[model samples]
Target: MNRQHWLTAAVLGIALPAACLSACGQDRGGFKQIDQSFSPDASVDAPDCRHQCSLDGRSIVEACTGTVVETCPDHLACGGAKCIEPCAAAAEDRSSNGCDFYFQSPQLMKRLPPSCYAAFVVNTSNQPVELSLELAGEPVDVSKTMFLTKPGSATLLQHTGPIPVGESVIVFLSDASPEMPRNIEWELSYKACPAGVTPATFAQTLTGGTGVGSSFRLQTNAPVSLAAMYPFGGATSYVPTAGLILPVASWAKEHILVNGWEASESGSPGIQIVASEDETEVTILPKRDIQDGEGVKGGRAGRPAKYMLGKGQYLRIVQDEELTGSIITSTKPTTSFGGHSCGDVPATAATCDILAQQIPAFEHWGSEYVGVAYRPRLGNEHEAVPYRIVAARDGTMLEYDPEIPPGAPTMMNAGETVTFRQGTGDAFVVRTQDTEHPIYVAAYMTGSSGDGKTAKSYGGRGDPEFVNIVPAGQYLNAYSFYADPTFGETSLVVVRAKLRGEFRDVWLECAGNLTGWKPVGTRGEYEYLRVDLARNGRAGESFGESICQNGLQRMKSEGPFTATLWGWDYAASYAYPGGMAQRKLVEAPLGSVH
Candidate 1:
């Protein structure tokens, strides 16, 4: 295979050994015990009542049908069963409420590479939203307003003109629906632009929405790109492509690491970066690389590109030859991608090639994330799907579920990554103690090629792909997205927290031919369901590429949840692109009563 194509397998983390595939379908076990102090309130905690109160009596209407809870106090409003104040009640807390939000990065001249442009996404609720732009604290008029009316939707806004590098710009979502909570979500990003022109194309997927702000310093955008190599530590080459990485603030700095292996595996893995043609001179630093003479060295023993990149120009470097993690610093901002040419995880009996991911610009990193490990093809559980967590700053802390006590990494430094060999479990939750500096998280499917010959199974097909975890803070109660018209084995993976109750109801409507849901398996306090779009309706008619117009599916639920879609053909599988949802803007504290 062409070396560049090898990166595709790495991008998905596929190519697991049969041992890995055999471990895919582990029991959906129970959750770890949570602190009672933080538990959500339900009528079960109310005063003596022989029977659950009916709304006709002192009952509060709940999310699921045939259910009732103790009535809320006079001041509290019924949100499912818990009595909570209206979202508008906390209107003054503009920073925390989802209804009204703002994005601002001070003069980048001092912190970011010069002449960097910005990118952002705005998630709107059922109602229309209005926003304003300001620079250096002065209002700037915006002429374009984009919308996606397929149920719940988000709009991506890329500033076409170069933002004054040294000046600050603020985009505020101020006008929200009065009848309903504002439910507006936004994220900011920056990328060093080429001196004389923009890169031919741009890439990133919208990954988060819903929820009030948890910290003013947190930056959250969807995972738009990822690249990996094959056979663990092999050296594969890639055709260089230009992209952007915007700094979060003037203080933005990052640690990049490229995993190293023995030189016998093709060659040593390495990383390369080019400066934009615009007279931008960046200082390149050589950090830790394999120290042994046979191992990859820092900057791979110095293969020179340039200390600075000019407009329309590029940079390239190699160490261990695979681009896992390597640091890049510039006098101004810069743009780039991360991945490998070929490699495999879990020593699998499948294809051993992968691609790279457009690294989510450091400016878009967040502290909380929710994700599901990729599953082996049906009948191929021997292939164990896995996931990894990479820290973006020093002293970054982490906590996750399906509890890993003896193995979890609580403290991480810049450029460091920890992989949890889950070999099992359907979903996971990772949260950071310091929101200001969040880490990067990714899920890789155990390797499998639908050809179905090796794992001793009838069901199997396609290569593997990586799924970017959406931040938990961005979880939404509603989602609308499209499935590729050409991909096969398309499906949706939905996960929800059960703190609110044993039953969290979700409604899904797709292709105008199906409108209902099937109960999913539960692992502790979490409930998850997988819907195979291809198998939902009359085979090959309502679904499976036949319903492109109807391919737009909408999901809404009584509680907040996150959903990601994956599609596979006879040879490869990928998380559907350009999907979006809305976060909760006005719900009360999980267990708080008015």
Candidate 2:
């Protein structure tokens, strides 16, 4: 691999200098405080602002700058994140971000690679799922599993494994009844260009009309969260991208797509929409002109085009043009995804891979986020990965801590996007001028060559994979995540913040201690660290059989944090955020979800 353009972080080992360590400062979450006595100046413009503790036991961080004038949500009073007011009390019904029901389906993604799907059902409810269920229900046999996250008791490591997927399936508790609404959450994983499949339908993507074409009708008695990982495998040109799967209750009428640039003969980049309710009407306003191919029609650039879809039906818009700024709105709640069928990161990267992520509605967007890269493309530690920030509202002014690469836009219009590379083995925080201006940020694993390895540090190790970076304010303290144990390697990146200038620790059930946290960037006093969870070269490889049952894990912390899961092999790899709080950081239409 080439090393000419990679950043310096000591190629062989990590070089965390003493000056990069935080000597003093409140280890609060992503919302950097002004010149408070507890921490150094987070902003030169607001050096005089400070935080005070109320006699009633609540924290109040006054805005130090004129630009910050937004009010906190009903549950929060001061500062911008859940970390500041550690002792504040408020009435919250946040049992867990799950719903009584959810609608889900599957996709083929690309034609070249044979695909297989797997799912991990998480018991987000406080009560244990003591019984076994099958079909669309959770396919977990509690006895062989590690054990679910228990309430008010010593933690027991649980590994329920991945549920097998087939046809259009429903995910609901067998015991669920209309009188008792239960919520559940699940993660979807796609094994790329796999070794083999017994039958062709094993990796089939739902095609054709309504009911028969529909996927999951997740009618639960409890709340549930949904997300997916689209991974492409083979000997080369394979990578993964993942995003939070928004439930129908949280869906909005409108959404904006974010993606990397790619216009090669090999793959095309574009947006896709899936209908939740029958007879859903969708309109697309493409950012660039699209060309026609296969049996699909093309939407003219700069013009609004409409399409009607039935429940479980999906639309794929593949083209040579970029779709980063495209806008899609529906008459009813719908699922929207964006990425390349198989393409390059910058149009010049030697190879290309599949990328697909379920996008959150515009209403779920946030202004504060922290973006970090994977360990260092397998072999190269100094490799600098790429990241992009997309604006949800016009006239958005972006601010970045520790500076940004030149040409990265500080001012952006709605549907506009800006790209910059992540610093060598580091993380960076980006926030809008205020809370009203929401944006979406994503991280991408650099693309590699045919050998599954590129020439330079920035070039290859794994292939191209991209994942949405859930903002800090939307981060949570608990997560039920799974890593595919079949890969040659599997690992996670855990990013946590401090509360009230005090240090906080997080625990991963599969692993001990959750230590060795290093500052994200040179600005250590900023109070953030990029910690590794699993970096071993191999993770007990499993073939096509029950993938998740072998790789499930649970993580917990005292305060909000973010975890990203990724795995790589010869030339195949996948990446996605483990979980997110995804709170109501921005305004949404009526009946939107967290």
Candidate 3:
């Protein structure tokens, strides 16, 4: 998989020759004027630049040395031609020599197949630049130098192998970012690696304590069966990853993605798929035990029943009972991940072990959320950090921050669920007043700290983990994720929307080397900050230990923001919920299409 096209000579500047890259300048009616500072006989230079220009200087661009270049309508860089000005053209576009920002993806296996792609970059700029990579266009020898760290930190590189479909994946910023092209932002998250497996390519920056998520987690000590599909079927559904199944019948139903539960004798485990062409109709309701917000209603949840699953086949439920929240539906698209053969999540007494993640699909659910609850461990404030809040649509009307009125829940119809036990709050921001029908919150932590209460407190047994929240419409003035290096204690809660007076121009930049941050609580527009990232923790310690010690964080914002990351070590715990690496793994290659 490697066709390599990589183009963006600093925003397509010098690629030329498609007939001079489309007519090379001087089109008058279409505008292109330059010459107010005139006086450029200094031997010649500016005959290239291309974006806006018309203050009146009789257009005339032709310099491939054919010389004639004298333009600048209103777009500066044209009177001579060495060209500059391009942070996307206009906010006063600059760079006589600086600000650079590029984003290229050509196809990365478009529509799906050759698989295994990975490219994420988040330097949301404030300084510290130089970060290059280009595969089809050459240049990619490991080039580094990115410091200036703080706005949520980020850097996962992986990609020197599998890519097959026309191939192309460039990500540049090789030094530019006087806030150019908005500094930097990239994303690509391929999948499909089955035939012989082998993933992981080369460039590995991932960066200290990573934190953005497409819902990843399948750690291993032994048994493992985590497989997720979808090479190209997102952005609403193109559904064609490459056979085996996925025609989606006609798609009017069926979309459970992944909801396995059960922690002990091993229960809760289900994965469904089908659609090798037609007759889709896949289903699974098996309530098994259902109790974490019990038989959810409006969003429909009685469970203990229903069946189906045929078209192409793929279903495997694990031992005993308790298929924790299992649903699985299908009318069209399909992709699934198996669950707990070994278990552990919110059980906490000593260690219950094993948990996996990778379900998301309902088009990557989101409707505004923030999490950091389940507190405990640090002298154990009596324990509390359980969370579940499902409901993809149907009337969804949940809300919470400091007020957990009966624990907040006014509606919740489609797929219904609302559980929030364990309250020692310091961060929770549930939201759902419609925001175009989005609701799928998730947060749970319980591995040990058994002393917090009885059955061993926490989740009341031992071992439980699942985190999925970060949906302020996928907020992203900019971001980069991948933190969970596992040293433990890394906390960061940040949730923003507060706009009123603009909250003093809001701030939080993490990667170019930190910046103002302050906030511990504020409910209305939502605001909370609490950072720690573990360098060996200890700033005001209540429960701080080695959090984001540079496993990759790179955050960003001036107004809209989103974040969530917890990493406990009392016994075991790791959370994730920060989005926007192009809204959860690249779909909006450049547009804004979460």
Candidate 4:
């Protein structure tokens, strides 16, 4: 007996099949088992080990003897050949690396790590299927394999791992071809498994209609996985709704109202509105029990509300239902008077000497004074008394200060009497008519000599003697001169003047010039004036027979030379003995030439 006898005994005890015993022990079968007991000289052929068997109507031969055995049909093993039952199909495998996958109705879709390898069994009649993965919006290719015709089938596919960090992916499945069954039922498996990757878990599902202005809040008890999304500064899409209105002091973002609706992260804290090129965000007003207008108003009255005016500054008003008015005040800088110099006067001593004559004519004289009284004119008097004295020839103007030297008093008063020494060039004396009342006096010198015209005279003056006697609030005339040749053949040199008075504490002085005067007819009666010019004939002319005397007489009662006296009642009365005083008046020196 050879090793085949032992194999046959072992097979009988194990309830072995007939084919296994015949193939293992006999040579009649196509398989031949080598003899293991032969000495070194033993022949290679085995004679008693031949066997045959039939599988699915096909014959097979086997020979058994030693460690090496032979059998017919190279693909079949006698003892190992047995009918294998189909196993349950494996699950389909999928891989995604920061990518995504979507499945059609019949095909199963899944998201898997790059290392995950899966197997899928194809037991149904459905044809092969195509799988696709996408990232952002682009596609990626995976391994390809064919399905077998066997009823129970399986497929092994390699899986690509997680997409590189900071990236995303997607995967999808579909029929390999349109002709194939739409329902692709298959099982898949892979060796690799999903690693550290986890599925995305959000506290709340994203609602379909949610958008930019919508409000939302994170669900309580949900583990915060900030790592889930990129650009973690904060998500603009989701906004907190309730407690978000008043966040903790440490919360960096601010809340606001936009277009009458609540908005978030609007402007810097403490500010009500935030504006950008694309949108405008405004702070939400605190809900209060008070009515709408109860709170302070915002932009109005040409200013911003407690804030600097910026590029887009505009008025935003808050009003009650009644539309009541609101007042606003702000601060700015100040403006006051700066001094100016009065122009020059005429050159002639006579013309310039009478320059003091124009002082009181200023409309502001009386009221500007302190502790002084100004009686514009004699009791109920209508006629104007000459307060200003001027040169008959060239219009040289002058002012007189009887009580004080020129420029002595910064201020002058009505009823002030100013006297001038007969031949004192341009010098004159001024006296404040009232004890303490004062007014302003200014003088101007104009015109050029040998210009075939006289030196133009312009100034302001009033009589201290008369102004002091007239009652307060009385009227007196003010005078002015204008150089007009059109009204008369010779430049008429019309001294147009007016008078205005006020009982107020401050008085205003009227303006004047020789070229043109303020017309008395245009002003109150108190602005009227009486003018007179005494003249002494030049040598070779008869005494008291010159044009100056005639002009004086003509001006004595009426015309531009006439003016009312404010205090004529207080005029000094001095009656000198003999004709000495008379001669002084008659022989008064004439105005000197330049």
Q: Which candidate leads the pack in lDDT? A: 2
The window of 10 residues in a row where model 2 has the poorest summed lDDT is 9-18
Worst 10 residues of 4 by lDDT: 574-583
Q: Can you write out model 3's per-residue Cα lDDT over 31-132, one digit (the tens) per residue?
A: 211111211121112444432221111233442222345543333332223333322221121111112211111111111222223222322222223333
Reference-based lDDT, each prediction: 0.35, 0.49, 0.35, 0.17
Runs in model 2 deviating more than 4 A are 1-110, 128-215, 224-244, 290-297, 378-381, 450-460, 521-536, 539-550, 588-594
lDDT of 1: 0.35
RMSD, every candidate, angstroms: 15.4, 12.6, 28.3, 61.1
lDDT of 3 at 147: 19
Q: Sort by TM-score, best first: what order?
A: 2, 1, 3, 4
Model 2: per-residue lDDT, tens digit, 46-71? 33545422211123444333233333
Model 1 TM-score on a 0 to 1 scale? 0.47
Q: In terms of TM-score, which candidate is strongest?
A: 2
Error of 2 at 18 (Å): 36
| lDDT (tens digit, per residue) of candidate 4 on 278-384 | 22222222221112221333333322233222212211221111111111111211000101010012112111100011011111122111111112222222112
Stretches of candidate 3 off by over 4 Å are 1-254, 265-327, 330-359, 365-463, 468-488, 492-537, 540-554, 557-564, 567-574, 580-594
- Order of quality (lDDT): 2, 1, 3, 4
